[model samples]
Target: MGARVTIVFAALAAIHTLTPTAQAADAFATPAVTINRADWRAAMDQLRSELNAAPEVAADFALTARRRSVAADDPRQRPALVQLNGVTSAIFTGIGRSPVPVLLPFDTTAYLAARRKGAIDPQALPRHQADFQTDLFDAGPSGYDAVFSLPTEATSGLPSRVFARPVEIQITGSVLTYDVADPAGGKGESVKALAAQYPDLRRFIREGYVRYAFTRFGVPYVVSIQCLDSAPRPRRLACREASPIAERFLKALRIAGGQPRRLPPEIAPAAIERPPAPDPDFTYRPAGDIVVNSGARGQSGRADLTAYSQIRYPLDAPAYVHSQSFGRRRASDKFDQPWSQYPWRDNFCEARSFNVGQCASGFGHQGQDIRPGACPVRRDGPEACDPWRQRVLAVRDGVVIRSTRQQAVTVQVNTGTEHIRFRYMHMNPSALDADGLLNGRSLREGQPIGVVSNYLDHPNGTTRHLHFDVQLFTRDGWIWVNPYMTLIAAYERLIGGRGHEIGTEMVSSSVAAPAITGTLPPAAGPQADAVHAPN
Candidate 1:
């Protein structure tokens, strides 16, 4: 540690303000390639058909991060701000004694402000504490700051970070530098074997780490070794210092263990204990005039929703129909069959009892409810409780950013400002476990994310329909965007036609409509938190 430089948050903010703001024009727009939905669907179909035709192969290798410690005497010091490429990052130091570091979108101003005050407001932290950043703490003149945590010296001494959340690297040994003498010779083998063949590489991992750096979305990504339990402090290495260091590090890394099972562990099937079904007398109504909530800006105008944003359907084509439309007040008379509809339209703002002015106070139904056409009846003709039989499809090509098993699955589309989040709820728990749905997995349009089921905490909490919704990235963070028209548009594309009404069809006709309860009561029970829509 010859010289130490600590760049605090305030200085970082000042420097960032002074830096040139001009960025490549293309960065503000999505990719130039136009998406042809038909072609995309055909490609997906072909890929699936080919997969069904291919032979299954067993996984042959296990990839695991080995626990290796770097020597204590390593001299490298962690940089306050390491920005080699487009990405500018800071090391995350875990909260309290937690070994894992908290990685979040960098927000220099907040971090500096927190540091200056020698405390952090817990309420100011990102709402989605795991992976996001917001200006929730910087509401300067507003008296809404009480939502943040009590100020504490949590981030006081750390380097000025892009975010108030700290970034940290796990420590172990010194930064080991290496080079490949011959690329052709070092093909496949463990470091131990490689050390025996190339004696010069023997002391690498045991003593230090091989560092590498790159960038994505104007963000820099750096890889390096950590020197843990070091005498003076932890050490890090820069891959750019020497090309051989990177090449040799790559050659030394190899899969040594045999392949492990790819399937995730299965969870026990959650039991379905149906609550006393509601017998509310709700009137059936078709989609009425679109009421504009003047309080909410993006939703004030009346526009054809079905013709807006490009997105695919969540359910399979043709057969599935909308039981309730966005503004429809129609609901099933039977308490147990909540998803059963009256008007053959889609259901959106049925939670009107929660609050008035649909999209204004964020108190109304935020999304639409869709069902898989008919309920399968058992042999004796009772409602067939086979909720997992139907498939829930991805509405677009996006990343499965958040997959909380049965709770929900949220896919995010990241095409510049067109970025939107699609969430699917009421997935079968067992099916979700079997399919190994997890976070960070990239998904294609039409991929089967999970089976349709009523598994919200319990199997019988609600009806067996996917509660689908859309969210947009706003200054307020990810806020609910009306999905009614989005679904209408997607459904039309799926059927290659307009929304078709069953019209005295078998299911609707057979199940006689319950007597209308002239005016429905205000939504009873507890009003759910607006931050999260009710299941």
Candidate 2:
């Protein structure tokens, strides 16, 4: 018993001795990781507070690696967001003349809305939105301003405003400005030879960008390198300067979901059937020869001098019905009429729609409205209503700037300084979705966008018809241009010898056509804007 008692006392003594050591260790040991975490949290909170306090600083935040909920963003905004998330997150490290770190540079939504507003280049606003923007001033690599190592954004709410200096940098894709080449050199071969001569081009192709340039309308363009690989490294530094930060930004990128349907093949221009009317003379016309002159209503001398015969008819059918034209006219004709009595005609400046100051005498119709076909008396008969038979075709080669599912689709031709726009309204929204006519998609001339319908705010706001109009960018902003002469020229080309009149069978896609190449001009630059395809 004494021995057991002694052992218990000794064990108690040892416990007492070890308790102080354990307590001391606990007291002296600092939680280095926990304290560091607290400090980081405080720093992040302070930084966010500072960013929120300064608009300019916050704008710059678009250049950094940060994210927020875009759940409330519009569906139209999704395509742009997907593009933004893509180009910004691609890692260009090891793809350039110099190796780069991972990066997230381009701000998709901000750039697309401002691309044509003249932020980067003052000469012409970009008519089409692209996935990336280059240094118009060419800030990187001496004499190689084309290197797109930096992501760019125009000042918020001020697209035309130029920055005092280039501030942000990025890892972006490369583009060949072949259109800028001199014509004296055999335009096509010169680009290839120039590419052969450029060392950086070699460097870009080795580790950086996919090689491409805009093919011209058979016109020779100058070749220049723009924005390739990643941002420039700091002098004296052998590797990427912003790599670590860029890596963080890359990880933060959130790619938007869903995919667009593949674009269908284009219709050969030679195969498009024409109306049965005599070919309209395309020679420069006198005002007296204008078919739909607004001057008939005492509004003369307001004609658009720049207007020419350019576009083709928007519909494809045997015959058309016209319940309305441009301007205000009280036509007692019911919405449903047989083709024999109400054949559609070329009516541009005729007296139906809203009033606009840009018209002949400050108060006239805004655009031409033509019905696809006569509606059947029965609401559920075979010929009751068939918008699909009147598929809307693009009149020119351009990018679809707006494809509002419920309202309209606007396509803009991006000529250097003479940008023009065409609008097609009253299309079936479900048909448009099925055809994949989303915003920013490219269209070939004669390409079917969708079927004509009577959709305005909902499915049946007006009778089944297509509203067409043209606009040109002038010093006074976008003004409506008469499409009379333009339609004459296009129709003559479409029909060849003499145009055919509306037949019992719709002219569009009805005539058995052999597969032939289309005559529409191909896009001249890298078509990397839509995320459906790679750059």
Candidate 3:
């Protein structure tokens, strides 16, 4: 908003570029606090023993994210269904290990009877595993469990981030919590009533999924039964039926994570900066600039005023911010059409595969497509580019949460009071698998994750460009948001200066963007006439 504030943000972004490889690696170098594994393990063991003494509620009540063999030796301190202490609660003290212990007041008899009434065997309910972010969690037969947002730096021991946290946190479902990706929340009488029980609870439906979010012990937890279309009547398995059960879980929820100290309130990201239109030739489209099936236009869309994360630029080399598919074909747009050149356009909500709630139409592209620095010279006396040569960097210090073989690599960053996720696409999944970028991996900010390459379902399914987006933690869990402003800020810091906003009158739809002066990276110039590789 102010020149002074812009300068401050620019300075911070500079830090990302200036020094990159420092995280837990710089532990001894700096006076930063670190936690030892022995100490962490000891603290957890103590917590487990305390719970065993308090109330050893034992029941075979179903609904869990973990697979348990009926014949396998039960790891609980007490035998299954033994009623160790009047059976007023249930303790999921993780089998085969005691890393995380959960104690909750549950009516074992009533739960069992209800399952039987519905003609379902409570004890025999299948343990439907939770899928990666691509699909929903199989919430078992009862459709509920004291789910935990695991894979966090505290819960999982990622080599780089394991020792980074000053204190460890306990999440329910223990090791099984690893499969549970984003915190999903949903609605109904059950959800509303459950929300009522917690103070400062935020409730909403994200992309048809209802959610309830609240903070406790300085960390945020979300509960969702994954229901949708709560119209004239509450959808089955929606929050209504879950209300009573959820209320019970919250009432019995213990701050078992053993968070030693309270966390401060979340600090909202900075607001959008509106610097004066510094250059007429430096044109760009505004947010929610919904492109028709076949209509290309110059500047005129209004700017969106949402705040975005100020993270590191994703690419190491220079890149052009443009659309890979603006070559809609109806206009005979060539593979190397100048349409892919500068005067960077905002394609966050462009028509593409996938759904985005941030888009005005509620469904479209979930990220911004960027082409890395100009293609290198070819051996055949021409300048052709290879996307695989460009390096893709980790935007921040975070844990890799994407499943094995999953195409999109999502890194979850849980620092301070913010829980954010950054996603990178187009890189081949097979390469990632070989590189050990699998789930629970730790990544430092600015680390070279992999080289950019075009690999959708098959090789080069789309153009050679990086489809990047940002997802913020909200009442409805993790959902996609536009990264336009964030990228602009990051680019400003990347190239060491600010970019001017060009007005509509200065642009023409019939022609591609003309080259201009600024801090923009290579390939920002007109590429309409340049011969390039096949998509």
Clashing residue pairs, backbone N/CA/C < 3 A, model 3? 170-257, 185-210, 185-211, 186-210, 186-211, 190-239, 190-240, 190-243, 191-239, 375-385
lDDT for 90 (candidate 2): 33
Residues 479-519 of candidate 1 have per-residue lDDT tens digits of 34456555554555565544432222333322233222133
lDDT of 2 by residue, 1-535 (tens): 0001111122111110001111131011100000000122222333344335545433433433434543344332333323332433232211122110111223333433353344644233221112223322211110011122222343332232122222222222111111111122121112243343221221111111112222111111112221123334221111132222222223222111111111112211111222444544322222222223433255443443223225666765333423242223334434345322232343344432223344444333345555554544435465444434556889887666432233557675643112456877777666776776755567898888877666654565555667777754321223455554345345455546343334323322211221111121111111122111000
RMSD of each: 23.8, 28.3, 15.9
Rate residue 62 of model 2 by lDDT. 40
What is the lDDT of every predicted structure here? 0.34, 0.34, 0.43
Worst 10 residues of 3 by lDDT: 28-37
What are the per-residue Cα lDDT tens digits for candidate 3 across 1-535? 1111111122111111111112231011101111111123333343344344424221342112234554455434233222222232223321112222223233333334444356544343221101101111111110112332212222221222211112111122211111111333333233455554466666554543445556432223555433323321211233233333334335545322222122122222233333433423333555444233311123222244343455788985356566555433224323345565556777665543233555555544567888776554533323434434667899888767544555678776654323467988878777887898965677998998877777755675665678888875443455676677677666656666556645445665543333211121111000111111112
Q: For candidate 1, what is the TM-score?
A: 0.39
Positional deviation of residue 320's Cα in model 1 after best superposition, in angstroms: 5.0
- Over the full model, what C-alpha lDDT does candidate 1 score relative to the true structure? 0.34
Name the weakest run of 10 consecutive residues (lDDT summed) in model 1. Answer: 138-147
Report the C-alpha displacement of residue 338, candidate 1, in angstroms: 14
Residue runs of model 1 more than 4 Å from their true location after superposition: 1-308, 319-346, 352-362, 375-388, 403-406, 500-535
Error of 2 at 186 (Å): 41
TM-score of each: 0.39, 0.37, 0.53
